[model samples]
Target: MDYLTATKNKKYLMYISQNYSYAILRPLQQEILAQGGEVKWFLEGNEVTSSFLKNNESHLLTIEEVIRWSPDVSFVPGNVIPPFIPGIKVGLFHGFNSGKRNRKGFEDHFNIRGCFDLYCTQGPNTTSRFEQLSKQYKHFAVKETGWPTLDPLFNPDTKSIYTQPDDKRKTLLICSTFSRNLSLAPKLYQTIKTFSEQGKWRILMQFHPKMPNELVTKYQALENENLTFIETDNVLPLLKAADVMLCDTSSILLMFILQRKPVVTFCNQDPGKHLLDVTEPEKVEAAIELALSHPAQLMDDIESFCQQLHPYQDGLSSQRVLAACNELVLTNPKLKPKPLNLIRNLKMRKKLNYWRW
Candidate 1:
């Protein structure tokens, strides 16, 4: 039988606690609906303000309500899967692990703390590591499914098309991560300010939502006729609009590479050959020029990098993820919620105020 035919009425409980998680899981939620499955969202703590729930109010349900529903599968983009939640806890992950900033903790990215019954990996870079860890831990099933969040980038109907503005100046997008040590914003502000004033390029700046409001305000004040500051959960549109991407250690650098576009990184922690790493402030302008002047020069390297990162650029990753979920639901015995991690549970309850005598 076909995939959708098999998942006609499957139930999916998506647990999200941040805009980043919502963005990562939103595509899969839509795909579930298309497959005739019932998908409900449970926002943890402050995630209720997520734009995903803005239009999807009807689909919102409380955590208690979710438990009673006992969905066939519970997907979490963030690290911790809710303790005692019914069904298979699947780790869908939030972003690509580019090994940026010398981050060695799996908890921040790939660590499985008995939270998930299954893990959907983005590519070999992640899958190989998780597979080893899975064997060592003897817990959780790992599947190599390219990130569902990026599926829309490859979809013909949904893919963003870049259109040059009327003035014809190439668009430059500068994105920074939240980590102050790795973020390029504070250090590059003067360089960007100089460039923004020149009017030689159309500049777009996007920062991690977790970035402090003080920093955001500091950058927002820099907006001018040539420079625009963007603050939104969705980045695909911005990615599609830019002719070149300037970034630090953020995984969006990998996404930009997948677009076959040139990316200039500011001393990326986990440096990739394709990315033009610029350390000196004076060299930033020259790197941007090189990218715009010779995009063809790096096409081969970018394609090779993308192949190792995520080979399925055809936009069906969401389908594959849903298929895996459905198959596990039908074939595997219903998973009984494992014994709760008392410490983790208490921490979560305190965080979400789920206290009950």
Candidate 2:
């Protein structure tokens, strides 16, 4: 029997994120708990052990132990053919944001890909793309709720943490993270040095998680009174303080686009490059240097990129996500469709060519 049938909680189950905060996870969880639903967490990664959960009172079970209990919804739930507890409603955290492959290319990864009644989405195009590719996957017409980590970006309290720079220097915030692929680092450093020589911009280097210690120290050693490298979680506050943002598409692009600031995306990753058209290396180098020298050109690039980059600016995407989840598990429930039906629907949608959007 489904655990909800017996325990009688809201029958909504949340898969825990290693990093938790009011940003995205907390609000949905708060909604769940407020409705008298039992909120359970599966502890596996650092997310469960994350200091963020220290004082909060919630029932947490290890991933291995969860097999004995019934799970209603999981973030990626159990890999394949998840232990289907009788009477448990099912849901999943949706999106494959890391890779360039569209919904069609990722079909091979799903063990029981079509089993969920509800699939929460990342944006409108993501919703349209998935529904076009898999008829069984329902993409509700709500705010294409953006990611949760961004919730703090929308918070009012977050604004006060920043201090505007002095009049002498225009701050250039370089947002970077540790990539197993280091090809882009040397070029990026070279580009910054070229700009700094002009003495028009102050460069602040932001390191990504897992950045090499040597790499951090190498840049730190060259510190111009104008150059500073920071590795903490204060990237957003830094973005607010800056005149411009330069990063290799680390979702910080979303933050800048939301703030309506100009941004330059580095397309250095191999498998997951940016989808939009990018300037060539010569064009890129010239643009960066020219923009740095002039700085006013940032407004033009900001406006240009906004056409393709800023679709999910609704800002209240979290609420739409919770509504979609509630509809699937609470208001209306459906069963997983057969893979054959899913593929057949995919084939049918091709004639409509809705995937082109």
Candidate 3:
């Protein structure tokens, strides 16, 4: 069977749970539409705002409607997807693995819960591990297709929302993980506030959607001529706008580093040569200064890290992902049956009120 032909007129469902999933999956949607395929979105959970859906986009309101539509494939950015949904489940993970660990002390990125038939990984760092798990489970396939979200970062045609300030000072993007134990927003608040008052750098602050409201309020209060608090579904523009980034244990730092820019992490869980990891809040300012200098060794380390993290800079990851999905659908390679996952499915059913088997 011709896989390329198989993709024509295909039906796809963008399974979204968080606001950021929009940025991650929209590139793939554009690619799907370009290939003469149909795309629809299914916004799950209350976290995703329905207003984000544009006038041109189509979305199903209920599971029954989703069943009636009967898509050929469902692309999920979040961890869970209902098995009852009629489609080949494909996991397009939300973010890179920035060494964040779960409550059980195990890395959360590599945890396979048997919810997907295939995982289109970001790069070698993730592909190799998922491939090993695929062999062990014999229930899924792994393909390294870079990340669809970063396609706009490299794509020249894509317009960025970022506009340069007239002052032309260096921009420092500050982001933090929501994890209470790993968050730097609280710890570095004073330091960042001082930086803003001094007006040495243009500060842009964005935080995880799940970050504490109190901390968000505090940061928002710091907004001044030099400091700005940003709230948006997509962070790609911010990544492109910043000259340097300050983060702590958040995957966004990894995304920023992919641009060959320097990042300063405050008490990062897994520090490496690529990052200027500082344990003390007082040292953060110095680290930012160092990162701005772009030392030879640090820049080289960042280059090496990017190659391992995500080598594809061609802005065609969406095409590659669609090709992978088409090949899987057309060929239908034999593989072990996926596990029942009774409890998880039960929870999903309860959440969606979808009882039909």
Q: Which ten residues in a row have the lowest lDDT in candidate 1?
A: 99-108
Model 1 TM: 0.92
The lDDT-based order of candidates, best leading, equals 3, 1, 2
lDDT of 1 by residue, 1-357 (tens): 465556678788888878777677878888888878888888888644645565653455566687778888888888786666778888987778767533563335765577888888888877898899777766567788888998888876774434455758899999999898889988998999899889999988999888888888988998999899987778887888888999998988888778888999997877766888889999999999998875664777778888888888888898888887777767784444444688998888777666653
Cα deviation in Å at residue 234, candidate 2?
Answer: 6.6
Give a tens-digit lDDT track for model 2, residues 1-357.
232223236444555443322223555565556555666554444423444453664555543345446555444332222333222333334222333333465532232344444445565535565555445344222224555434555666667344543546677777664564422455566666666566666777777545677777877776776677675533556776776667663545555555665555567342221222133444555445554553555555555544343345444544555555555455444444434455644553453232421
> lDDT winner among the candidates?
3
RMSD in Å for model 2: 9.5
| TM-score of every candidate relative to the true structure | 0.92, 0.63, 0.98
In terms of lDDT, model 1 sits at 0.80
Segments in model 1 whose C-alpha atoms lie over 4 Å from true places: 1-4, 47-57, 101-107, 159-164, 295-297, 333-340, 355-357
Candidate 2 local lDDT, residue 186: 50
Better of 1 and 2 by TM-score: 1
Instruction: Please identify which of the two predictions, 2 or 3, would achieve the higher TM-score against the true structure.
Output: 3
**Residue 290 error for model 3, in Å?**
0.6
